[model samples]
Target chain A: MPLVYAGVCSHAPGITGRKHLADPGIRDAFYAAFDDMRADLEASGAETVIVIAAEHFANFFMNNMPSFAIGMADFYDGPIEDSDWLGIDKFRAPGNRELSHRLISEIMQTVDVAYAEEWLLDHGIAVPLHFLTPRFDLPVIPVNINCQGPPLTPLHRAWTLGEALRRAADAVPERLAIIGTGGISHWPATPDSGKINVDWDLDFMDRWCRNDRDALLNYDDLTVYADAGQGGFEIRTFLAVSAAAGGAQGTVHFCEPIPIFAVSCTIASYDLGLLDI
Target chain B: MSLYYVQKFLYELNRSADLQAAYVSDRRSVLDGYTLSDEEIGALVDPDIGLLYVLGVNGQILMHFAAFHQIEWHDYLQRMRDGVDEHGPVREGVYAMTGRVGTGECG
Candidate 1:
């Protein structure tokens, strides 16, 4: 059976490697985290990775959509935006078809979705990929959850999808690793700009990496996610990763306040039961 | 397998309408393609899938309870592994309810 190693990721343009190259402090943290994660990923021996995430307008437009989408491509590349901050134009990653198609067909019964044979790498993927497997050498199976608009899958649904993905991965008989990307807190709009929910955000990170769903599920009613904060959606991605990790405890690598933007720059990794890969 | 539970959940969510239509319009197609009976779809989860899916489900999420009406972890994992045989639109309009990706119809 395959093993899942998952965690929450920050999507702020300033913290992610592709968008923020000039800031020395953040750049170092980002690179160090990437190196550590890459070594861990390489050590894990997982030839395939299934990434669960929420897309920010990187590819899909307003008209065409999929609640759940799987990416099956021959090669995947990144650096979502080409800001001078990051000199590198692109990096490589692997793609798998047999697994992606199987997962898509399986997800149809629960919700409407589609299969994308091609994809343009975005920040959500780029940031994590840069750290987990910078070489982009491993084949990746991308799974998407629509977190932006109405009728979006609730946080709970996102978690379920993670499990479904795990099932899909396990059936393959291949060494597999799973990662969920998004956030814990920090809304990205001007009106609410500079707002940071330290308590709620920090609480989310603590409970999540610890695999404490009881603490997290209770927050469905928490105000930080609904009115004062827009992170409720992104938080779902974190839950998915926790779910994929099968309740494995995680260690927090770094957590610090990001200026101007309410987004927190944090990095952490979870325990996947398999031996390295 | 909790077929009855899944049936009730589907009815409540109006997903049953889709299932019914799938069943009536193309019996064999639905059976071979997308429909996985309770008996058929309950075996895929070994440890990895079970842990991931269960992580998403706390014993308390309202939908989790509601979902229990139809199938359980075992069955869901099996469906994930086997997939459906029927042909249908992979993308539909309901996904637009949430706007992460662009929304449109897929035929």
Candidate 2:
């Protein structure tokens, strides 16, 4: 399958309905860009989408966290925390089981990745999907990263995992759309939890838009943690998507600093360079 | 102090309708079941976002708890600010004050 589309979006729950809580202009600008991005995504003519988002200990508790896992089930009843407010009705989505199986087997056997048959579409996956595919009709393949757990997945490994996903997508004979959700910067739960690392967030966005993979991958996990705050680790998902896109550089849809949520919510589109390797 | 029980309490309330009903009808009695400290219970029952934030409950989880209480987004946010002001710089957990809130002042 030719990887037809790739992108990243930051997950800030309040934006779906409670956006009035944020600066009105920032909210309006983000949605305006996001609506345009969604239209482009809809126009991409993709049949199956690969959604890589964080699994916030919702499905697997801290006791049994996996660094990386792909859901193998045919359907999932989306997560609780976000479904309540995001206004997504019949909040379950059918999975692209065949593609998911291909990805799971390919990554597990070849790359030694983990697999899960029971991961609900948590806010990590749902918030972006709510905006990208509002009708819930698109068949999705949900891949998860451990953004909040310890013995953290090294940053480089996340990028390699993206490369693996690219290889997997190369094997399939269909058009694939991939989305990595979460991050720019925000510390969740800390005293500075609402603090946005504006400089850091913008720098990361600029590099990603420019497809500066070398610079992005050069920063070690410790550097990322120190600069971006705890929840900022979600950038691993974004980088993974960038890698999956063959490091194809593209336009940044929007990058708005949402102070209320303390998140630099973003939506960036990429040129999908179909990989043959 | 471990924010474990507080997060656990909020997680159940977020996922289970049964817990929601129990928490509302007999909030203390329901809290009695969890292995929470008195302070945790006090803050939770008060539904004090400030105290909970001060107590080191993760914002991602705490936000849901605030929403369940129908606290507006803006107010839940302000409560966190109020937390630092009243509780005196996050007494425990990951957000412990590293001697003021700026870089180059690192511990």
Candidate 3:
């Protein structure tokens, strides 16, 4: 089956862990957007969800980090954070090792991705799963783009990975959904945690919705750090989804900076029906 | 000033419940494994979040360490600001304070 769904959303721990701290009005609106994303994913008849996330130092550390990695296990357990601290209970999400192996093999044809048999979920994956796959029932294939550490994955390379993922998804018989989760223009996990660049975010989303490859890859990391804070490196995740969308236009479902949540709190996806796939 | 090891220690501790238990039981022994400066050792032992931040530990790792100590979110941010106020600027890493401190929506 061709890739059935492709979208992106925010995955800050504050989105779930600090929900009570945000204004209930904007908070509920943001959550309703998540609900719409879930509805769209379900409506796609997706059998597996491939979550491309800019993970923190959860699984990969500086010791031996891969620019890109995919999970290959029958099951994965997480919030790796203290359940109370993250406000998400501990649960094991199903993984399909067979599906992962095939996908990794296919992705390796184009992108040199490391395959991990063991992975502990952090908020990057956990927060999205809390909404997208609420019951933890769907088989999840986790992909990580090393956006945290310096000497990060280059922007264009992330696009290649996404293209590779789309190829693998289409080659497979089972329907697959791709959801990329990360912040756009916010400083997270620092004293400047709640800072967001609304203009920068809106401009970037404009390029994203237009699926303009040149504009999306035009950003350099130093400028990103200055304009979007260090967290802006996570645009790699979004860029990959755009690459996967294969020229399909997108719609921004929700986007507003909730300082306490530490991001613009966005939810957006491509119109895959526009493609002939 | 072994910021790498300091962050590495926290990275391991944050993900491992067993190491967390061991650290709580005998914090000193946990220090034996990593090559760290006395100041780094003291900061980790004290778990002085602000000092660690000024010492250049990445907030992604440091935040979890703070949470492990039951530090609240706002308190965690304040501790980092206080660290910068007392100890000059962050020594290393990409997470240095950008002087855009009070410009956030939360302010």
Candidate 4:
């Protein structure tokens, strides 16, 4: 199956339903974009979706956590955020055991990847899952990354892993789609820290969709981008997704800063180049 | 000092409620029982301990129990190893709807 790839957010900053949290204009735009991406995934003839994202407190604690988790549950649940932005109780998706097992073995042969038989789908996974396939009807393969810890893998490592995933998908006789979620640019801490580095963020996003792995990995001061503000350098997920997309270029959907919580509520979609790939 | 050292020292101090009282009665005995080296003891009481003691009682105790006085790190690792042997390693893949949280959040 041709791989349909995308970058989606579960909590689009202001969209989360706290009266103090919603930005009607951006929220509208996010929904519209979500619908468009869902249509795109459908058009790509995707049979299974491999979602690469992170876990909040759901599957990780202050203690032990793996750098990666492959979903093995029969179904994965989406989290509800109390507020309307994400209050929708739950979304469920079927698990693809055959493809999931194949991908895990392929990944482990090259790196120390972990297999989580029991992992609760956190907002990181749920938010995007809810947006793309709202009914939770799709069969999904969720990959968890340790985006918030020490001994944090390098950008190159994330790229290599994504490349491995690309290979894994190519090997799957069944059709597959890939979704990479988390962060456009919002610090989440210290309200004012959410300023979008428009120039840098856009630059990274541009290069990311093109699968410019070497360029991204070789960037002289990635930590500065990661530490420069609250965006937390999670833009790397996009880079990872781009690698899976076989380096397709992108077109912007929504790009603007929603400063209510001091985070830039930016959302964009890249052309997955199904025909070209 | 490393974050680990500072956290360990503060943790030990909080584990014993009578630490201050015990220190006053006989510092050597308290130090001896924990097998703390002279350097560790010196570092613990140093006025410049900085943020080591700022973790409050509970934080201190937890850190101490984790690092020095309680279960060994190898034991926990062993448990993980044993679990993997018994239940198989945590498998990774696309899951159906399963959002386990709170007490059973992490495996």
Candidate 5:
């Protein structure tokens, strides 16, 4: 089956961890958007969701990092930070080793990818799941791009990974939903944590919604760092989703700069129905 | 100088509850295994959020270390700013502070 859903969202730890500090008006609005995304995802009847996230040194470290990796475990446990600190309780989400095996087998044909039997979910995957799969009933296949460490995966290669994922998804019988989660333009974890570049974010989202490959791939890391802060590096996740959308246009459901959350708090998806697949 | 090892230690400590407990019980024992300068060792043992930030430890790794020590979010941000104020700029890595600090813009 073709991908049932394709979208992107923000997954900063602050989104869940520091919600109490944000303005109630904007916070509720963002929460409502997430709820709407959940509704759309459920309406798609997606059996499993493939979360493409840029993990912040949770499982993969500099010692041995894969440019791209997919989860292949029966169960995955999460939020690694303290429950009180992240404001999300520790929970184990289900995974299907056999299905992952099949998907990995397919995705590997085109892109050299790593498969992990054990994955500890960090906020990159945790925060998004907290809203997208609140019940933890749906199986999830976690994907990671090297966004944290230097020598990160190049943007073009990230696009290839998306194409590989779509090909793999199409090969499977189960309806798959893919979501890319990361910040657009903000500095996370440092003293400048909540600083957001609204203009940079808007420009990037404009490129993303148009599915303009050249425009999206045009950004260099140095320019992105100067304009969008280090967190902008995570745009690889978004670009991959754009590539997975396979030229279908997108819609920005919600986008607002919520400083306390440390991102432009966004929710957007592709019009996958436009594709003939 | 060995920012990699410094981050490696925090990376391990952040993920393992057992290591966190062991480090809390005997930090020196845990510190002995890794090749670390006295400053790095002090930063790890004292768990100085600011000094560690200045030493070029990625915020993603340093934030959990701060949380483990029970540092509040705002306090955590303030400590990093204080670290930079006293220690000059980040000596290495891509996480160097580029924006103005203490501008009341960030939370």
Candidate 6:
């Protein structure tokens, strides 16, 4: 049971300064932080990274939307929507089709996952992976958590998906590194969208990293999220991965406020003990 | 229903560089294609940030629309307040103000 690396990431920090990418240690710490994660990932003997990211109304719109989209396609071409800002070649993305199928069936027990074969990774999926590893060869099982549309997936349902993924990973022989990529209180598309609530973001980080589900999920109303920012809902992605990890505690790799994108980007790696494999 | 139309327009604008360019060049023609109400079209073209949000234009779509206009985050939040002052309350969207703006009532 090689469920070695499990954690959450934020993608906003390095977006504005492509220039900082030149000197990985320059303006942002995300580059160096990823370098460290790369070392850890190499040590963990983990092969596939199951990226939990939200889609920005790219694949599904008002006409057709699903709570979840599981990618089982053997091959993936990258970036369906133009993400020229990322500066990565969106031509082809490495994928793990088999594990994706396993996840679809596992997740279907509780939540019906719309199986996707032809779609490519969005910025939510591609940006983090590309930044973490220079080449992006580490196979990924992209889980597009639908956060864009209304009737969005509730926190509980997202947690259910996380729990299912944990069981699926442990039950099988695949060493899956579940990485939830998004959030820590920053709104991407709102008018005050660029403002990151450091206080709220830090509160979430402390509770989430310490596995404080009681405080984390104590919200009776979601306007609390709206108060934080629109992208605040993206944390549902984190909750799913957290549930998958069985509420295990993890190290907070880095949490920084990147005002350029008005999103807090971060990385944390968890070690959930093996399940009688 | 009108908010849905606004959201659709912005959603398309977000993913399409060509559409963004077209929007900036001639918003009137691009907006005319959509069957939006005068209020909806006016809010969009005039760049009424708050009214658009109150009108139920989902934040996901509205934020990018705000950015396209180079609206600062502070100004964007203020615009919503301004909309309350100028355009009445959020007429038919998610942010429709109930009892009072400061009150704990919004449905």
Give the best candidate by DockQ. Answer: 5
Quote each prediction's TM-score.
0.64, 0.87, 0.97, 0.66, 0.97, 0.80
Docking quality level of the chain pair in candidate 1? incorrect
Output the lDDT of residue B101, model 3: 35
Angstrom error of the Cα, residue B69, model 1: value is 54
Instruction: List model 1 lDDT by residue over B1-107, tens digit each.
Output: 33223223322222234664654465444444324343323311121222222222111111222233344323433332222112111122221122221111110
Candidate 3 residue A20 Cα shift, in angstroms, is: 0.7
Give the per-residue lDDT digits (tens) of candidate 6, residues A68-127: 887787766665444444456665667877778876786778777888887766667766
* Model 1 spans > 4 angstroms off: A16-23, A77-80, A83-88, A106-112, A189-194, A226-228, A260-262, A274-277, B1-107
> Would you list the C-alpha lDDT of every candidate in the order shown?
0.55, 0.74, 0.91, 0.54, 0.91, 0.69
Listed in order, the DockQ scores are 0.01, 0.27, 0.55, 0.03, 0.64, 0.20
* Model 2 lDDT, residue B28, Cα: 90
Query: iRMS of every model, one decimal?
Result: 18.1, 6.3, 2.8, 18.0, 2.4, 7.3
* After superposition, candidate 4 runs with Cα above 4 Å error: A6-14, A80-85, A191-194, A219-222, A225-230, A274-277, B1-107
Candidate 4 is graded, for docking, as incorrect
Docking class of 5: medium
Q: List the residue pairs that clash in candidate 3.
A: none
Write candidate 3's Cα lDDT for A170-261 as tens digits.
88899999999999998788888888899999999999999999999999998999899889999999999999888999999999999999
Q: For model 5, how does the per-residue alpha-carbon lDDT over B22-70 read when each residue is reduced to its tens digit? A: 9989997897878889999998998788889888888899999999999
Q: Which residue pairs in candidate 6 collide? A: A189-B63, B50-B80, B55-B93, B56-B93, B56-B94
- The local lDDT score (0 to 100) that residue A89 gets in candidate 1 is 51
Measured with DockQ on alpha carbons, how good is candidate 6? 0.20
Candidate 1 local lDDT, A47-133, one digit each (tens): 787777776645553446567777977766665444333234577677987767776676665645677887766666776776676
